[model samples]
Each structure stands twice: as C-alpha cells, then as structure tokens.
Target: MTATTLHADLLGRQDPQMADVLAGEARRQAGTLQLIAAENFTSPAVLAALGSALVNKYAEGYPGSRYHGGCEYADLAERIATERACALFAAEHANVQPHSGSAAVLAAYAALLRPGDTVLAMGLPYGGHLTHGSPANFSGRWFDFVGYGVDAETGLIDYDEVQQLARAHRPKAVVCGSIAYPRHPEYSAFREIADEVGAYLIADAAHPIGLVAGGAAPSPLPYADVVCATTHKVLRGPRGGMLLCGAELAERIDRAVFPFSQGGAQMNSIAAKAVAFGEAATPAFGSYAHKVVANARTLAGALADQGFAITTGGTDTHLITADPAPLGVDGRAARQRLAAAGMVLDTCALPYGDQRGVRLGTAAVTTQGMGEDEMHRIAVLFGRALREEPSRTRTEVTELALQFPPYGQ
Candidate 1:
C-alpha cells in the first residue's frame, strides 16, 4: 500500500526497526537525567498535536489567504497558534511560520536587512548561537556580523564596548540573548544603545522565554523591535520558531517568512505550539520556571563545593557553564562518562577557550519534579562520574531517577 493509505502508526507497523531506534531514545530519556541546556521533553499533549492530521496539510500564506486549497482547518490552527503566541508574550503581532530557530533568525534578517548590511550580535563561543554570527554560518557569510564578547574578568557582556561598536559600525540590527549565557540579559541597556544608533534591537530570547513569561527574567518585548524564539527550550513547546513584533512589522515579517524564507508551514508543530503556550500560561508553569533557576543555583553551588570552576562564578538562570580543568578531565570525556552513568549533558566551548567545558541545565529535572536536594545530589554524581568510580554513580543515578520518573511512574 502507498503511504497515504497506511494507518497513523505506519512507522511502528511497517518500519519496526526505525521504530525501535525511536523507542530506544524514549527509553534513554526516561532512564537518564537530561541536563542538555537546549533540550526539553514536551508534554504528551504536544506530542499528540504533532502526530495529528494537521501534518498532512500544507498552508503557504497567512491564515485568510492560501496558495493551496483545503487549508480552511489549517488556517484556523495557524490562527489559534499565532493568537496564543501574541497573548503569551503580550506582543501586538506574531508570525509562527518559521520551521526552526535558525529559520526564524534568517527570516528576521531578510525582513530588516539587505545583503552586506552590518549586524552586531554576541559571539558564538561567548554563549551566542551559530545563527547569531559564527563565521561558518550563513548569518556571517550573508551579512557583516560584528560579534561582541563577554568581559574577560566577569563573563558578562561589556555594554561600553557594545556602545563603542554601535558608534563605530552603526550596525543595522543589534542582537541580544545567548544560547549558554547564564545571566539575565541587560535588555534596557541594549535598548538604549540601539536607540542611540537608530538600530533595531532583535532579542533572541530562545533559551529564556519561559522565564521571561513567568516573570523570572526581564521581558524583552517592550525593548525589542523584533523578538525571535525557538519555542522548544524553556517554553517547552514543539520544535519550531516564531517572531513577535509590533503591528507595523507584522505584514513584512509574514512576507519574509512565507515567500522569502520557508514555504508551506508546519501546521502540526504550530498546533503543538498553541498547546504548549496554554501550558506555559498556567500558575504551575510559573512556579516550575522559578524552581528551574533555583535548582541551577543549588547545582552550581554543589559543583563549586566539589572544586569545579563555574565560568561565571554562578548562574542566575536554568543553566551553568563550567570548566573541567580543576577536575583533570576533558569536557568531552566528562560528558561521555556522565552519559554512561545515566546523567546526560553536552560539552560546550567557553569564551576565549576551546571545547573545554560542559554546559548543563535544570529545566528538565525541575520539570520532572526534581528539587534543590536533587540538584545537589546530581552535582555529586557529576563529580563521582568524572573523578571517581562510574559504576557507583550510575547505580545512584538510576535509583534517583526512579523517584522522579520524567512523565510518570
């Protein structure tokens, strides 16, 4: 039979081998502690939305107009997704068509910039994303992206230097937010600098939107001309992206996302985004967001106690970056050992350094109902997995994971 005639469970029935690999991933997720900074386990509701029949349709234009027929229901789903997004962020307009964060970033660039326009963004090794301005990425190749790094001593953005670059280069857009920076962004300062240079401030709050929505971090909506986010990280949404902007830029942004950027929107992911946005607006999600940062501090303190060097001395958010020099372990090796012990996180590069550190977050653990005490214990497990015996740590981690099953018992 052709794919169209197959039932919804096509993979499980006809592609059992690939389905087993997927099941193995799910098992690994349930059995291990996920500390990856950018990853989150979306709710079963979001998963259901992803698997819904919405995936079978294609919508090429905005809700009311479409390039194809049979998009009535698709339009409603996209409208619901866009409305929820605007409500969640209190923005006047939202475009939820971009497929990934990088796509969103690219769309934003296409909306506001011509080729060869100068853009100022955080450096990649200094917690910025590849899309931000890594020389190897399209953002760098297409436009002149002058990166501003963190202060050498404090591991924080140098506002003075940013202003200097703004004065010197007068970039068309100034980007804020980073993939791994633990400190809350100085959005107001960024706004002031952008204003002085007549630059559009684009805040890439991909990693911290949930915290911002929960009031744990400063909101960039008031300061940013265009805000781009992945919706998957802290917001716990499906894998997609959105642009929150003023009504004045909404049509331009829509055009950029539709004709200039990606085609045929992912209706299913947009439906999943609506569901996750509903979950995020709850009081329970607010408490969970606060606890995520609290757990991070506890974990960082515990690691400090174990003599591991936290890059910024601590964290004010869900994640912390730590150098492994003190542990006498390579960051990659540390990650492998921790994964073996059923504690999973990835290694990352610190500012002005090689890939010599590991980055971990408490979002997933806190979402799974783990608390400060668990954070401390997890830190100890990190030390044991790296500095001591792996078998003992693996057993301990398994026991602890049993207490807080990710979704349920």
Candidate 2:
C-alpha cells in the first residue's frame, strides 16, 4: 500500500491519536522550511528499514556475541551496519550501536579516559557542542575540560592557541570539531599538536561525517585516534550514532559502548544506518553532498545581501551562522519571527560576543530539490519575513514549501 494509506488506514485503525500526531508532523514538515543544520530527509528505503521487523530484536552484545538468544538476524544486521560504516568512513573498525551522537562521544571518552582526566576541545561560545565541555554536561563534570576559542578577527580556529593550550594543559585528548564553525578544520594541524603533547586526537565529526562519506569534505579517519559521528544529519539515516577507530582500539570502544554506556542495540536503526551508508557511497550522494554546500554558499551570500552579517563571511559546508542584528532583531527574536513566518532554524553562540546568531543549513531544502535560485528566493523570504507582517510572509513560505514537497506527491 502507499505510505499515506498505510499511515492513515492501518495506523488510524488502531491508534488514531498517535497516527494523527504523525500525520500532522508530516504535514508540518512538508508545509514549512526545514533549515535546521542537524536535520535531513532520509530516503524511503531508510525509513522502511527503520520501520522494519528488526525493531523487535534485542541483541545486547556485539555481533556473534549476544547476551540473548535468537539473535542471528540481529547479528547479521549489526555486522552489515558495522561493515558499511567502516567502508563508508574508511576506518579500520566501527561500532554502530551508540543511540545518539552524544552517546558515541561518551563511549569514546569512556574507552580512552578515566574520571577527572584533563581534555581539550572547542569552547561552547565558539560553536562547540554541549558534549565538548558545557558546565551542565557530563564532559565538564567528569573531566577537566580546557576550551580553545577561535580568532576574534578571523572567526577561525586559532591553531597556534590550540597548540599553546595543549602544551600547557597536557590534556589526555584533544577534540577537533564544532557545531557552527562553517569551515573544515585543519586536521593535520590538530594531529601534529596532539602528537607533540602526547594526547589522543578525537574527531567529533558528527556534523561532517556525512559530507566526508560523500566526498564533499575531508575525512578525519587518517588523523583521529577515534571518530564519533551521528548517522543522521546529512547522512540521511535513522537517528543513531557510531564510532570509528583503528583496530587496536576496536575492542575498547565496543566494550565502552556496550557494557559501560549502553545496552541492547537498536537493530532497526542499525539496519537503516546500513542503508544510508550504502546510499552515501553512490555518486548520486556525492553530487547531492556538493549541492548541499553549493546551496549553503548561495544562501549565505543571499542572506548577506539582505543585510544579515554572515559569520566567517560565508560557509564552506552545509551550515551557516548569521547575525540578524542588521534586520533589527537579535537571534532569539529572529528565530521566533522566522518560525511565525513558517521558516524553521536555530540560534547559536556567536564566536566573539555573548549575542547569539542564527544557525541554518541547506541539507533539508537541497534534499527537496531546491537549488541556487531557490536559495536566493529563501533569502528574500528571510528579509520579508523579518520586515513584513508574519501572516503575509507565512503564506509565501507555505507556498514555497508546498512546491517542493519532501516526499513524492
């Protein structure tokens, strides 16, 4: 049966309430812009895998070493997922069991570090993820985290300062990644600094791993001692996480993920991740990945033309951080106005100031077949949405979104 029929007829037959919620969400997604950097449209095949019978399985341990019985299919699914992840990222080992990106990072830390160990990563105000070292996060409580910030003038990572920090702090690990930097990190520089200070280089590549998979970004596999990534985002998989490392760290990483951090693999998500990896390996995905970046560049320039202060001038990847102060609004107010106008995005920490900036990406729109011209239109809409009445702007935004339905008509 068709997707609509399955959702409405079958699901509505039993759980009409939840089905209505699901249907409403689907309508909402199709009826509004999804500019969130960390969101994407997974393929129908991937969605099917997520809804597959594998969801019933509960394989507690790794493939061929389960804690429970009747795990043959689960083993096969996990094995395939692990193999595809390793091949897709060019890593010697892969663990496809972490439930989220944070879990993967937790497992990485558990495998390599003890409580109270010193670590270094990007500062929160500089676009670092919460797991990096937020006072509210476990990373800050369990480990002494020394943050490294970007250059105030360039809005880029201060590699020299990073080196200085590493030498002085002598951290056990140095993480190289950010949530809103809008640039590819100098992995080699990080590796060299880590080596100099005898620290392991951990690449929290949750944002860029999909681009790396599609050959749109540089791979951190060659430099990082361990790489933690989300299977979703631009990867277009089910919500999950994975870890990659050399063979020497495989067992340690696996044990950390299984016994220490989590239990019972989500076989369905694992299966879906395999599907996404398989898709990412194709030339079509490579083209899509490049288009994602191209669209973001176009959108950044367009937004800049509309008076938003584009951070770092423009973006090199799917993400863009822009200050809406030129539009007479702060990031929080801008986000509310945009939401009222049917455009969805987030506010992020600005590198130099306490003021927040809007963070957006082209992955979802590009997946819906939007191009450079559409990017320009979206920017125009941004200006009108901020300056004009919300009702009028919302009508145009809905019309634009309907024209590019994320799912087939």
CA lDDT of each prediction against the hidden true structure: 0.86, 0.93
Off by over 4 Å in 1: 1-12
Question: Native-vs-model 1 lDDT?
Answer: 0.86
Best by TM-score: 2
Per residue, candidate 2 scores C-alpha lDDT tens digits across 57-176 of: 888998888999999988998888888888888899999999999999999999999999999999999999999988899998899999999988779898999999999999999999
Q: How many backbone clashes does candidate 2 have?
A: 0
Per-residue lDDT tens digits for candidate 1, residues 51-145, read 89999998888888999999999999888888888888899999988999889989899999998999999987788899887779889889999
- Residue pairs that clash (backbone atoms under 3 angstroms), model 2: none
How many residue pairs collide in each prediction?
A: 0, 0
> Scored by Cα lDDT, where does model 2 land?
0.93
lDDT of 1 at 371: 93
